[model samples]
Target: MMLRPFSKSGSFYKGNLHGHSSNSDGKFSVSEVIDAYKKRGYDFTCISDHLWIDNRFCAETVTDASKYNTHNFIAINSAELHTRGKKYDKENLWHLVANGLSKDFKPSNDEENIQDLIKRAKGDGAFISIAHPEWYSLTFDEAIMLKDCHSVEIYNHASTVKCNRGSGIYIADFLLNENVKTLLTSTDDSHSLEEDAYGGWVFVKTKELNEKKILKSLIKGDYYSSTGVVIYEVKLEKRLLKLKFSSSNNIMVSGAGHTNISSHGYNLTNAELDLENFDSPFFRITISNQFGKYAWTNPYWFNELDLD
Candidate 1:
């Protein structure tokens, strides 16, 4: 089966799942952040400011449905939850992005256990995402043990801006190799417009642009993460995995045991991989342009199929 985002009927909506405002340590206010994204042609945005004592879901106060929702834009209620972890050194922390949360939802500040927080967030109907594993230098053993997370950030714009260590593809690859099913996301995690905003986003395929539909699509993995390149379609039939994309200089298929199939050229629009003889447990695709912009597809698990 194809691990694709688009279906036959729905349109694609561009959105950033992680972002911050003055409600936290971010420089921009909630209104200003919303305005910036709307002007950038984004269809929706989740103002996921930090959930802490001082911040306290401050973005909620500004997320007025009538003021932000229009024929062209939407605002989603979200937050970044940080919990104390003992697996790593004193400085290391566990950060999770909780999407589609209630405005009045309260997180336990006294909760120091990361796993417990994840469970609570899942119970609250929030889409949980492990955020910036690379930034925390999270090990595979540390990350793979966590449960109830829908996705992980393949790229975090804010982490990249601060330390140039925001990509988490290694952690993702490790989990996929272990047959743990999960999706990937690219988020701005933007705290400032100049350095972080609009750097990463996900293209969600949904029937409409409303908050509920968009969040549903996100949790269902009906999305592809991108830094700049655009993927038009991804399809799988029998043993062939095909992709239709915008201009890209390189298209690659990555899988277990260092399996890699790649095509490099100019003005490339489509690519295909024949997986009939492949034995990898899972496989995913990435497209990159000459300028280093990238788009990634969610991994397709082979063990789940009756490919006999």
Candidate 2:
């Protein structure tokens, strides 16, 4: 069953959910990161500095609030959960990206479970996602097993470069799960002043520019993912799911249940294909450059409630 393509009714804000700054291990400051995304045409961004949740109230709260309002920014109030020991000389820790948290919300190194971090985030009305799963093996499995992780970064532009792409860590997860519902996300994890940092984005459809509306749509799987390629449209009305590309480059649309067509590739001159009986409830898209580096859309669900 094929349905009409989804059309954009209003403006959509391109955003990044994972970003770093000097508040953590990143080389830049929070304001500097925001300036970079704004200059690059990104409408919104979240700063999840490692192990340090930037509680706006601690220092210069009034000044920071003023700056945020002036820039028209939607800061999600986020932090990165460090699973590794706190001491610098100790073993490393697993990291989870979190937001909408209180300044007092603290987790011990013994409480390294990703689920616990997610629960805390959600309990406080925060939207939670796993950051840079490809960087560490422990976090990658935790991402797959955790129930409420709204999404995970299949591509982390900065981390991927640092880890040399993590030995196909995430691709194997997709292959193992027969009923996976989480959407794939790409984030720049940008700390430096670079425009094309490989991955660093969340595709969302929301007319209102505030934090509540955008975050709601994002957790509900209302958008796709992209590195550089723009997805002009994606819709599912009948038994068919149609995707439209914003460029004439090569693209591929494949999924778990439709004819078992794994990794189907096609060159795009504005092409469209009918996916029949896509009843698996999980589908994704990929757009790649000639170099095989690409962006992957998180698994779009057909008819399932996200229980996390």
Candidate 2's residue-wise lDDT over 85-132, tens digit each?
Answer: 322213455556765555556653454454565676678666666666
Error of 2 at 212 (Å): 1.1
The model with the greatest TM-score is: 1
> Which portions of model 2 show Cα errors greater than 4 Å?
1-9, 52-67, 84-92, 107-113, 139-141, 166-178, 194-198, 236-240, 257-269, 277-281, 289-295, 304-308
Residue 254 accuracy (lDDT) in model 1: 90
Instruction: Tell how far residue 156 is off in model 1, in angstroms.
Output: 0.8
RMSD versus native structure for model 1: 2.6
Q: Scored by Cα lDDT, where does model 1 land?
A: 0.81
Task: List the pairs of residues colliding in candidate 2.
Answer: 1-240, 84-92, 84-93, 183-298, 184-298, 187-199, 187-200, 188-199, 188-200
Tell me the tens digit of each residue's lDDT in model 1 across 6-58.
Answer: 54368999999998878777788778888999999999998887774434434
